[model samples]
Each structure stands twice: as C-alpha cells, then as structure tokens.
Target: MRDLTKGGKDRTIFIGKSLMTFLKGHFERYQEIKKQLGHEFNPNDLIFFNSRGDYLKLRELHRAYKNAIKRAGLKNARFHDLRHSHASILLKKNVHPKVVSEQLGHAKSSITLEIYSHVAPSLQEDAAHAFDEE
Candidate 1:
C-alpha cells in the first residue's frame, strides 16, 4: 500500500474480505462515474478522487470524517482514532504485536507496543489463567 503518512515509506497491509468487497464496489462506482463523464476520465486517476478526478485534500477528508463522527453521535473522535481502534481490537483478539505494527506501518514492533501497551494488562491476565488451566 502507498504510504500517505509522514514516514513516506511504502508498506504492505492486508485487508479483510469485507474491505475487499467494499473496495470492489467503490471501484465499480468509480468506473460508472467515469463512463458517465464520456471520454473525460483518466485511466490513471486515483482510486479516491473528486468528480473531476482530483485527489481529495486532507482538510476535505478530515471534515467529512468529522461530520460522520458527529452524525454517529461519537464525541471527541478524530480520524486518527480509527487507527488506534483497529490496533486495540486486534490486540484484544490476541494478534501479535509485530503483525499489528506491520499493519500500522510502524517502524518497529516496539513502537506498536509502546503506543498500545495499555491493552496488554487484560491479555496478560488471560494468559495467566490459560497457563493455570494447562
């Protein structure tokens, strides 16, 4: 995947089947829009773009995210919170920190551990109980 973050380093991230289906639907919509434009569509256009095939500005995307959060009645949520939420869910499900770090495009697993260590206590407790059972 393209690295749109400050690091500017490209990394691969796996998406779930549901996300793949969503992306396929999104691309199909884009193709339909392109067909409607009648010879105005660039084949090399970005996946996420405006009607004119221009990439969305960061501010525009942020505003949309904010609006969505507000509509969902979520308080104090930012777009970046989605990343943290994903990491937290994966960690809680017993995914390895290294895998999470790679998905997050962090420079190291230690960075993922550092940022999400708060989720670890419960996991540790679960491990202790499982060990006792064994």
Candidate 2:
C-alpha cells in the first residue's frame, strides 16, 4: 500500500501464489499476536514492526538484513540486491520487458531494459529462433 519506490510513486504489482500464501500465513500470525496483546495492540500498526510493535527503523532493518545474509553465508550483498535479483530472474525467464517494468514500478520500459540489458542477449536469441520457426 505504501510507495517504497525511489520516485515515491504509488503502483500496483502482482504477487505470485506462493507469496500470497506466505502473506496469508503471516497475517494470521500477526492477528494471533494482536489478539494476545489485546489492549496493547494498535490496529494501525505496520505488518513489519519491532518487538515493541513500533515500525522498524531503517538501521534496525539493515541490521537484520546483515544478520540474515551472514547466517545464509552470503557475502557483499545489500538489501537492494534482492530487487536486482528478482528483476534479473524475471528477465532471464523471458517475461516481457513491459510486464517486468510495470512490476518494478519503473516509469518506462527503457529504464528496465537499460538496467537489465545483460539478460537480453539470450532473449534476443530466443526471439530470432522464434522468427526462424515462423
């Protein structure tokens, strides 16, 4: 619901079924926690919050990400890399550039292409083969 984009523009993006299921389970857990807290629970609290039910600060989020990366044996990775990874995976799978751009909330498909041109060579080969078949 919130715009976390660099341009601060609000946009809608589709989530996969697996992610939707994960979110449903997360919401159920949150509701249970809220019920346990009763009067202490703030209905308007963010889904991601600190132990005290306050919105997580940027540093706190970064610290948690760092800890997770360390635990997962990842090196030289930042939180923003997750976005790059997602887009890269989608592009490599041959999803349309327009769709990828829209999902990434980029103002233009060119931006997506410019950022991810490295993934385009294989897609170009695929396109040439498709044309050959036709």
Q: Model 1: per-residue lDDT, tens digit, 1-134?
A: 55476687667778899999999999899888888886557556788875567778898888888999989898978778999999999999999889999998888999999999999898899899989998
lDDT of 2 by residue, 41-126 (tens): 75566778887788788999999999999999989697999989999999988888899999888899999999999888988998
TM-score of each: 0.85, 0.84
Candidate 1 residues lying further than 4 Å off, grouped into runs, are 1-9
Regions more than 4 Å wrong, model 2: 1-9, 132-134
- Relative to the true structure, candidate 1 reaches a TM of 0.85
Full-model lDDT for every candidate = 0.86, 0.87
